[model samples]
Target chain A: MTETNKTWVLRSRPVGDIKDGDLELVESPLAPLADGEVRARTIYLSLDPTNRIWMSDVDAYLPPVGLGDTMRGGGIGVITESRFDGLQPGDVVNTGLAHWALYNTLPGASLAKLPTLPGVPLTAFTGPLGATGMTAYFGLMDIAKPKAGETVVVSAAAGAVGSMVGQIAKIQGCRVVGIAGSDAKCKWLVETAGLDAAINYKTEDVGAALDKHCPDGIDINFENVGGEIMDAVIARLNDFSRMPLCGLISTYNATDPVPGPYNFANLLMRRTLVKGFIVIDYFPRFPEGIQQMAMWLMEGKLKFETDIVQGFENAPASLSRLFEGKNLGKLVVQVSDEPK
Target chain B: MTETNKTWVLRSRPVGDIKDGDLELVESPLAPLADGEVRARTIYLSLDPTNRIWMSDVDAYLPPVGLGDTMRGGGIGVITESRFDGLQPGDVVNTGLAHWALYNTLPGASLAKLPTLPGVPLTAFTGPLGATGMTAYFGLMDIAKPKAGETVVVSAAAGAVGSMVGQIAKIQGCRVVGIAGSDAKCKWLVETAGLDAAINYKTEDVGAALDKHCPDGIDINFENVGGEIMDAVIARLNDFSRMPLCGLISTYNATDPVPGPYNFANLLMRRTLVKGFIVIDYFPRFPEGIQQMAMWLMEGKLKFETDIVQGFENAPASLSRLFEGKNLGKLVVQVSDEPK
Candidate 1:
């Protein structure tokens, strides 16, 4: 193995919009592992909206990433060297902190063994069947609590979590509406995902479109894109509506604060409930989400989609595709050939 | 008594703001009572923020007040004439859909006798010990659920529900911060209401001031005023903070849509929960709130103040004072007074 590995680090804090120059790829010799530490080679990398949040210095649910530090992300890897008990070489594991690198050494406690899912792709462990799937399953069934005969609307419908949320709502006997950026995504959501209705937000006025389709108004709104689309959803909420806020992909790369349509008074007047949550908060129920999602997939009740970009060198550009709404589904970067 | 009475009716919908001309005081003769109807006189009218919501044509939690109809409100009154078995003359009771008039007829089912609270002021049954106190008590305890040693903040701190909310947080062993409009109100909050800190929002920079006082960030925010103050509070929320949204007094009277500061990303980044509630939703627990509040009043653990404006003729002007931030406490209008 080569002594030096390439990793991406934050070069400077982004002022308004993030650019590729803001991140730098550097080569450095892998540090020798201390006791209870292991060296692992990256196999697959996950890109999410939260990475954009880590770039800002403002106080949030988590601390801001320091300048010159490795960009934080989740990855699937195989252990190449281990000094820890129980962990052995060639063991595949899932870890939360990973850089855009080929090889890295981290503490043993930071990694969890990747549980085997028979006949499912190993890369599914990094996508819809992993954190993203668990987020949608728990966030909809637990927080939103959509009842039978209720109208459930999800934004970014063709994306990873949104796709799962629409399926889960349907399984719970709800009339589901999906909002996506393109007509093709809308058609895929309706034809493949079995959504009750799909609105192409790019071509139609979302608020008026929702009014025509959901005359009864939305009972539960799974919010993923929190900008103008959220403003549209707010106008169509029924009394006692619940909104499970998952992500804000629309505003992740925003240089300046995007001015919202601002209808907070509507929330109060409609007696609505809006809550923000991360999938990690529901760690206690991860196994349950996985079990249900797996059963659904096995029974052909759930379908999975991935927008894979080949090659480790394409990782940076692939990640930025999510912010531009270019990805059709769960976005992933193939780091290297699957381990034999 | 006369068979007919004078009542104030909504003559026209206000274009941007309400004025005296929009309402007309008119007299109409009452028809003979049918089988289930009873005649009653207006005694104590309940003025609330919900009245403003009812006036707007937009879809709200409740139906809008229709044109040329008697304005909707709740009132405690005495039966003047009865055609039903359960009600009789001089029975003091609470009823909704009561017209703002000297006297009118309603169904016997619409009225409920005001429960006797011995040694407690009857006016208390109408103010803090009534809907306002119940809203504050349940909203804080049930929704916000602040833990001991955490900080809880309330807006409109000198007003009815806000005053009770701060004291209740303190009783639960949490530090409390109050935001009011005047220096005198701030003094009253600290010296009289026993809040840990009070900020006169009109004189202080609320965002910067809150940062100095609540360094750990707000854990529970009982929102009553919802404009700039809400934006300021939203910016300082800690992870998993809860906001029990009760009212938006700031935007209640706006003729044009007021652009907000757009801080919803703060909700997502902080993993905060914001829930809007109407007091009627907590009706099943009303007895519990009333019993505890009554005991607290007797034990001197809770104190209440009211700004009673004399004469039903001044009701409209007095109600307007709430939106203007002129009312110091629970604003009520006195109709006819009897010798004590």
Candidate 2:
């Protein structure tokens, strides 16, 4: 084991887009664990749009990562050492809301041992069988309440939660349409993810595409992106449509106050229900979600991707791949090699 | 009964604000009543913020008032002649989605007969027992689902729906705060309506005032006026807050696309539920709402005001009172004298 631990510390709140020096990757000597504490080596650190939200000095769902602190994040890791019962060294676990670090020292009670599923890679725990998967499950099935034959629209459809949301809605017998930034992502949404149609928001006119595709109008909008894309979907919403507002990746790093959907009034006109949510809110119901998702995974009903960027040192820079739409599906930083 | 009917007909769709020639007061001979039709003498024509919405070519809750057609409105009227069963002459009925005219010809089945409650004046139907009252009733009770001890903030607090919302929320044991345009409206909100606090958005720093008034944070926002005022309340929303989006009077007349609330992201951060609604959507449940509101009124728990504009000729002009914040409560145009 290395004598020093490397962690990205929040340096300053970003004004618009994240820049160099906003976070500093610092090395520190690993301290001895207290009783009931476990030290885990990060195998895959999740690079989510919400990481940008945590870096900003704003009133967010969780408190902003305080300056000079190890930047807050989620990760999959293997326990290197344990003081608490049940959790043993070499047991792979989920480090919930831990740090963007090579090694995380946490209470053993706070960690969940990841069950090994046959034919599923360890990366699946960071994608389909992870927090992002549960987010898609609860946000769509719980909030959006997709009914069979309902037209479901998902933004950021090629991304982690969005991809899962599209597939889940499809499994529920909904006519699923996805909106992505790139033609490649759009193609992947329809071809690989089994979406009914996919709109490349960067290339196609979203409203026109939606009008052409969603002939019956949108019944459920799994909103992952906010801005004009949201406005377009909102405008064409069917009477009594439901929108599970899971993210606003479009405005995460906005310097100026981002304006909400232009067709906000349409929500009232159409009697649409828009509920904002974070996956952590559904933590208590994770078992139900996981069981259902795992069943779907085992049945070959769910497909997912992981864009792994090599190295823990590149954690801060790799986050930009999400904002810039450079990565597909779940963006993860491979901090260390898995135990063979 | 007069041989000719005076009706305000839409002349042109307003570009920003309604101007001269946007609507014309035209006189036309009353056509003979068809089977199931009743000729009603318009007594109290409700002038609401949605009147401006109907005047535009925008896609609204109801279809826009077609250009060159009689301006669509809601009114209380007495049946002068009926070709349908169960409805008789001298019965005062709610002319649902009728016209801004001296007389409205509507199907007897579509009109609801107003029940007489001793000590409740005819105007109460237009104020607390009518559509606006029902809007306040369901928007707060049904969508917002206010819990006892929760903080509820209502915008356009002096208007028909807002004033009623505050009183109902108070009755439900909520801490009610109101945001209105003028000191007089704010004064009435705090004193007469029994709200915890009131902020004059026109004269006060709305955000600062909201922070002071809603110390615990807003749990329910019965949004009426959407703009900066809505933005301020949205910013102070607590986790799991509910927003019943009833109206956007602020954006009704905007020439350009109105920007939605800047604190739109706060909705996601707080996991708020925002649902848009129009009162007509709750038509089936109006009896329950009306019974509740009427009981409160008789018990002296509900206080109301009616800003009656004299004459049908002034119906088009009286609508400006709603937009300009000139009216205290429900703004209604008295088209004719009530039956003596």
Candidate with the greatest lDDT versus the true structure: 2
Question: Which lDDT tens digits does candidate 2 get at residues A21-71?
Answer: 999989999999899999999999998888999888889999999999989
CAPRI rating of model 1: medium
| Model 1 CA lDDT for position A144 | 95
- Worst 10-residue stretch by lDDT in candidate 2 chain B? B311-320
Worst 10 residues of 2 chain A by lDDT: A1-10
Q: Please write out the lDDT profile of model 1 over residues A140-191, one tens digit for every residue.
A: 9889998999999999888888989999899999999999989889998899
Candidate 2, position A298, lDDT: 88
| Docking quality tier of model 2 | high
Where does candidate 1 chain B have its weakest 10-residue lDDT segment? B331-340
| Candidate 1 C-alpha lDDT tens digits along B6-104 | 777877776655788777777899888898788877666777777777787877777877999877776667787889888988777765556677676
Which candidate's DockQ is highest?
2
TM-score of chain A of each: 0.94, 0.99
TM-score each candidate.
Answer: 0.96, 0.97
Alpha-carbon error at B145 in model 2, in Å? 0.8
